[model samples]
Target chain A: MLEGELLGVFALTWQAAVMLGLGGLLIYLGIAKEVEPVLLVPIGTGVILANVPLGGLTEPGGLFAVLRAAGIDTELFPLLIFIGVGAMIDFGSLLERPYTVFLGAAAQFGIFGTFFLAYFLGDGGLRLFDFSFTDAISIGIIGSADGPTSIYVATMLGSKYTPAIVVAAYSYMALVPIIQPPIMRALTTEAERRLAMPTRAQRVSRRTRVLFPILSILVVGLIAPKATPLIGTLMFGNLLRESGVVERLSRAAQNEMANIVTILLGLTVGGMMTARDFLRPETIMIYVMGVVAFALGTAAGLMLGKVMYLASGRRINPLIGAAGISAFPMCARVVQRVGLEANPHNHLLMHAAGANTAGQIASVVAGGAALVLVPFFA
Target chain B: MAEHVVEAPAPGKILRVHVEEGKPVAAGDRLCVLEALKMELPMVAPVGGTVKALHMSPGQTVEAGDPLAVIEASP
Candidate 1:
């Protein structure tokens, strides 16, 4: 060993320095700005650890490598996260207003629309980026606004941009408050936003609550078998929560299981963000396209909301339509806030929640559809 | 007869109050409307009695143990 190469900081390259800075930025955003603290914190730590020269964190037989293989590559982590998500969500709103499912289905327009645009910019057309058909489909799923579905689909499709997709999905989810409001306001007039919806829905029976997960799994599985694993695990967790027979399991799934999987998933995603892999033109394009997909999804949901409003003789507030972006309670809160801004007494939370929860189911179906269609066309 | 109190079934805002002092109510009568998690749940009378006192009003926030109303048990 007569080499003069340094062992640590002296051996770090400019690329590693840049990645380290990016890692610091992520950590700052998480801690100071509170931008998705749960995810960004671990992701930042993973990025820093991976960028240290000779750390072997990402090398073969190393920690990051083993994590990637065990969780992401196998697509187990995302599915497990779904179980936790399912346990936490209460679908009573969606069950009360069954028709809101249409808005949810319509919001998926962004996924297909973005897929087409992404394909056109990549190998399918201009060759500006290296996006294959699978990459484009996985990228398009950012419109789902769901982190686990995006991770599950991207990992299953074997996209090289899994890290970018995951980051974009989580980042945009946090930005739902900022990104969705302008679009919602632009789509509806003052009168439309001020329109009040029924504050109370008929109380759902306990038996109906118990049956919902079972029925959802059956219906969704029958239509989209590829989505069965994603939908099945999600519903299974929901069943555990609603069944009232497994309180301990439900609590664990909601709290302990969810937290553990989130940490592992965030770290694995961040570990993939080494400079050589992440600092690329394609990554930029993916981020840009992700925003477009989210916007288009919101717009499509609004359009569907307008249609439903007109069909309902203007009883349905078009503001609730924006909640169909599948960003869960955040999107619902945005809709409610916008509604209150228009009319101080207008409480649109229940209606917005109906559409928001519907989007959750629809996005999963869209993910499943993409899984099936991409292979056929590619 | 001793007075029996009815507490909030869940933590939420009282959207509506359907009973008043001295109102005759049945065991299964809806006493008030509590909004929680976007669903409006009826806080019903657990036992038939005369409404003695109402502790909550519209738009009031209630906790699980917060007494909503008091009923004088029928003899």
Candidate 2:
């Protein structure tokens, strides 16, 4: 689909060989390296499928095309993916510590911050890596650390930068372990990391559990209409989980449906990685921008955590704020790991999870805000 | 009024429902108990409240942040 002269395999072009090697690397990373292997494996396979000399597999009405039409166009894939994500999420930590909601919002600076940078780099009103107003806005959302939101926004806005944005979102998500630590440490002292939040005494009623997803769906979805599908499917999964019924369907939503959609989504994403599309000066910039976006998000969250720490009279550990970057449980785990590293007695997982879940919701809001604001800037 | 949210202390099954619906209590009150990480973590109410409703019974597994109750604020 992307423009490029078909290469002859027997007499291979260097670009084809290089791309082939890169494709192999992605597969190796997925299979052996285990870096986001769930998504990477299919993405790698798709790269191999698309890049084989004269394969025409990614051609019109081809496998990739069908996947795109069936999976992405109906927006079913992103929504389905969210169901799995919703089941995977534990909102208890977040519900216990409500203040972390603000940390989540603070971390969304990446989306807005990247928008400004991309705009300044190009049209001021904005030009970025060949991105239009919507395209750049979508690309900036890759920084939000929420995969479904990133894909949904890109698809809805019809951004030409989907592949770039997708890769950026996933790659940055995987990099949470690597990217968050330095910023967290630089922002918080060992004493701050060692801060232990007084574990609260609280009990949630069973009725509240059942009502939560329903209320969240109605409240969040109604507030942001475009986000309804995303929040709706997400809450639908949560309701299945919390309702104590339909175990079979819940298992299917969490496992079978999720696994199938993941494979399709990953490969479809990789199909977009042709040399014509991928190997550009802008590609490097997109990666760079993605890294900056992630760094900025981590910084904002950690800084705010410091602010929370001061406000709570050191009851809140600043390290937990780093979890507000939308990487889900991974970022939360990183915060927990770092907190323990600071003090073996220090356990911030629950505190950090509050921020982490908040980040998830806030990132979705940030995506919606981008949809609203970028058009204005344009 | 500040809202109180009951967060899961550990990954576990809620073994007991200690608080009854519509019962008013103090800032510190046992709401439920979760068997998690080899300990019974008593989920307590952070603020004084009339227990509005119950979301779980004994033997329900819960993760962190599943709301167990909601109390309408008493002015």
DockQ per candidate, 2 decimals = 0.05, 0.06
lDDT tens per residue, model 2, A157-255: 887677778878887898889988988888888889887665553666668877888888788767766667777888788788778787787788889
The chain A TM-scores for the candidates, taken one by one, are 0.98, 0.93
Model 2 accuracy (lDDT, Cα) = 0.78
Identify the leading candidate in terms of TM-score: 1
Model 2 stretches with alpha carbons more than 4 Å out: A1-12, A125-128, B1-9, B12-75
Candidate 2 residue B60 Cα shift, in angstroms, is 16
Model 1 TM-score, 2 decimals: 0.86
lDDT for each candidate structure: 0.87, 0.78
| Interface Cα root-mean-square deviation for all models | 10.5, 8.0
Q: For model 1, report the TM-score of its A chain.
A: 0.98
Q: Candidate 2: deviation at residue A70, Å?
A: 2.0
Residue-by-residue lDDT tens digits, candidate 2, B1-75: 554555554556888888887888666567787775344555667678676667778999876556666654455
